[model samples]
Target: MDHQIQRGTVVLATPWGVAAIFSGVGSQYAGMATRLHQRYAIVRETFTEASDVLGFDVAELCTEPSARERLNLQTESQLALLTTSVAMHRAFERQTAGPAVTHAAGHSLGEYSALCVAGALPFAAALRLVRHRGEAIADVAARLDGGMMWVIGLDTGTVEHLCRLWTEQDVHPVHLSIVDAPRRAAVSGRTADLHSAAGEFEARGAQVFPLRVTGPFHSPLMGPAADQLADFLTGIDLAPPRLPVISGVDARPHPGGPAGARLLADQLVSPVRWHAVQQRLAAEGVGASLEMGPGRVLTFLSAGTRGHPRPWPVDRYEDFDALARAMRLGADDEPAVLDACLRIAVSTPTRRQDTDVAGHYRRLEETRRARKPGAVATGLGALDALLAAKGISARERRGHLAAATGGRTWQ
Candidate 1:
């Protein structure tokens, strides 16, 4: 574990490989997204765009240590985590020339963030949805007096047994909320139940670490919140995903549309198939994946997962080049550059457009603008500085630009 925490360079294979991206709650703190903000225009722009939707200075909140700490408050924490994950991905996409990843998934609140990034869900609307979700979860936890604990060094079967024993004890029963690895599981229930189970779990030589979370999330205890979330999403519009996104619930390619919404809603009361999702990604041909967010949690879980060569943590500017090297950039490797890190899904006939047609059309217009020539103009700000060193002929530049953007104007 100590060695895993240390910094080092990665040795990459010649052909490069596909990557899967995942992020979840926890591992958030003060100034989590500030590093990318300092170095990448995409990160800065992402926060700014979210800020407009949220009606608060999200960028300021994330970069300011004091405010960032307070951001851990229920609803604030969920939004902050999502914003940071999106910022990291956008920064990563801006620097890379082609598809960086072929698959993606987000755990719990992270799934909503994934949906927003995948273009299946709009950024502003996702924020509104998750904000409501976070609040509902917090409310349920308050009403039910919920709590959670992490039991390490125990398989899922053993953890389930322990949970059953406690639930039978009839003092605030807990259930598996997250199964992250072969020996890692989180049991959630009432606060007292979690506290009582600690001794027995530890007595059996397992490491019991209670979470500083607000609810027994992803367990049956979250049934109320799940129902509320389901109803809340009924009026929202969702589109088909462009690139495939794995579901945290079933560990399969999410069937985008209303069905996807149900899966997300059920995630509130179901154990997140964390370990299974990674294995599934490997099974599906992703040779590698990057923890494109504030922490190395997912990267740590990738160890020993089949077909996955281990993931890299792209949490800082230094990580960019290392990830680039891993992707075999500039090698004989074809740029399988992922489409936009976050793109709207293809129109689905089953999708019900939001009632606000004007706003919906405006968002559609933005999507169209994004596909036009030089749409990524702002993201290329850094590289623009380097172009001054040499002058290529207008004709040659136009030809190259035409090839890349389907004959669209360069500027």
Candidate 2:
């Protein structure tokens, strides 16, 4: 399936459902959420709430260039990404009535964002949890001189073999941390060990680049951090997700509550199976995937992969309209007119005396029952007339209609 936005509209070659993918660490920028914070009250409110929980101003950390160094720190970056991603999701829900994603997943620290979006964790609680997680990992990194590196142009088997070989020969342990693509993977270990193995990796026709991370995450060396995180998680309340969230630890739907908590803690010391996660989403028939935060990292990873879902980045203010349209159109195989009517009804504010919600739904059902060729057009026209009668402006109606029809204008 291919999703394209042309002339303020979304065009879909094949209608498939959307999967929401959250951004992880290293995706943060200095002003990633500045526009969002300025435009939406919900976004500002989210930041304020996060500040209350985090003891620092999240908005300032994300927007000021002076805070660049601080934002790059593991704890600060994780908190900023989580807060910004959740704010974006909240704003999206407000604009589109609700998210239209069939499933949700996150990379590395992003799993917390996915769980929050799935309603498994409250926003305040999520903030506190990630803080402790970041602090624990940072403490581990402070004591151990370790780091991670990305290796390209090498298959997974060869990379695994090389890691095993280096660990045995050099007495320095290095492990394959992430398998992002077929020939792209990341390794985690002590800084000296990674530097020592770089020549060997290059000798085997692989390109190596060190990652800007504080610690060698997703390796056995992180076992202490994982243990600390596990203890912290036991005190927090976790609810079952309203939507399925694929875990990076195993690329399977997370079983919420205690089991889900275990997977999250273990994730610190376990390799991220992103390749398997993508495959699982493809197998589930996801048509489009939306990156819900600032960077294009996940978008780039999903690109050019056969049988993978088409990836789109909702990283800017202008991306909301097209994203809403694409999600609305791809939500199901229902008639376009029905979607338009339903969206219009949901987006409109209700009066204090308006208590005929059931009647409104009955009317929607009646419209759905009319399946004739011209009936759809007639129903759409009637809906327009009703909106106009209720004092809806021409511009607002056009926007609503475009959202409903994936940017197609009615004649």
Candidate 3:
């Protein structure tokens, strides 16, 4: 007879997907997904009266790699976002001390998940609420010509001042979106405004670029969506949270119950106070920070400033055991902040003393002329930065014209 042991180290020469599934952040996601699916089957069955109307295949969409593709559809995206976050919150709570949570918050769609975890709304109710929100908000973004832009190397006050100045001078208003870092802010509005702002920032030596979202989110343009969402939520039952959760709208702890529901609905139109959320979390002495789903975007955005100027730590399932072990050692003994900083710092690009500024700009001109959007924009921006560092003016770059759109220049 053979004896089996789990939760113990087993050495292997090769890294497998199973290992990813069992380790750190990956394991949390897997556990959350599983927990949600089980509840989804039971809950969805109750609400879905007809097979044709409720035709979404949860097991297939969630389990398949192509699930994210389905999320591109507004309805599906909302559902998946809600389900994944809520499930993760539930799973995480069970694993950690339930009373250890002093404050809770989420970024954008993740806010609903936070509320669910905090007990302001039930998981099923939150899912249904977000579905309606996704549909309403997506419809508005499609109609608007506005979008978002990332502004790096500028203070938030400076960015806001520039936006006001730009709008006053006939350039559309730069809707300051989220303050992700000390020098990083996301601005939203018309595409023309964004392009103009990007050009201005580049002229002033800041790295500005577009994000891959379809519509202008977190601006006044989302007001209609907020209204509709509010109407929908008005009919739903809400309860006081088991714990306090911070609001991205104002960065204050929500009062829970009906107030929480209203804030969740209003979040569609409000700017996310991600910077404030991070500050609050740190002030509360939260030693470990975990991004509940998908990309490391949230983790990067929420990292502490008191540390060596890097981003947040990540505890994906692969590091779950380590995180668990660390948490057991208590907050004062936690390694999350240091771990997060190490992860980001090690990945930062190292600048060489002999790097070429002019030649780099020339290459960017060629790439932009070739019409690969991301490569063109990012490449050109980096080229511009290098050139500026070498004291090269934008106008003096002869091939800069090559980077211009053919009779359809960006700015």
Task: Give the top-scoring candidate (lDDT).
Answer: 2
Clashes of each: 8, 0, 14
Residue pairs in clash, model 1: 98-337, 99-336, 99-337, 99-338, 100-338, 117-342, 119-343, 119-344
Model 3 TM-score (2 dp): 0.64
State the lDDT of candidate 3 residue by residue for 335-357, as single tens digits: 33223222322332434443565
- lDDT value for model 3: 0.55
6-96 per-residue lDDT for model 2 (tens digits): 6754433322345788868645455558878887889999999999988999999998889889876878889999998899888887865
Give per-model TM-scores. Answer: 0.72, 0.75, 0.64
| Global fold similarity of model 1 (TM-score) | 0.72
**Candidate with more favorable, higher lDDT: 1 or 2:** 2
Each candidate: what lDDT?
0.65, 0.77, 0.55
The candidate with the higher lDDT, 2 or 3, is 2
Q: What would you estimate as the lDDT of candidate 2?
A: 0.77
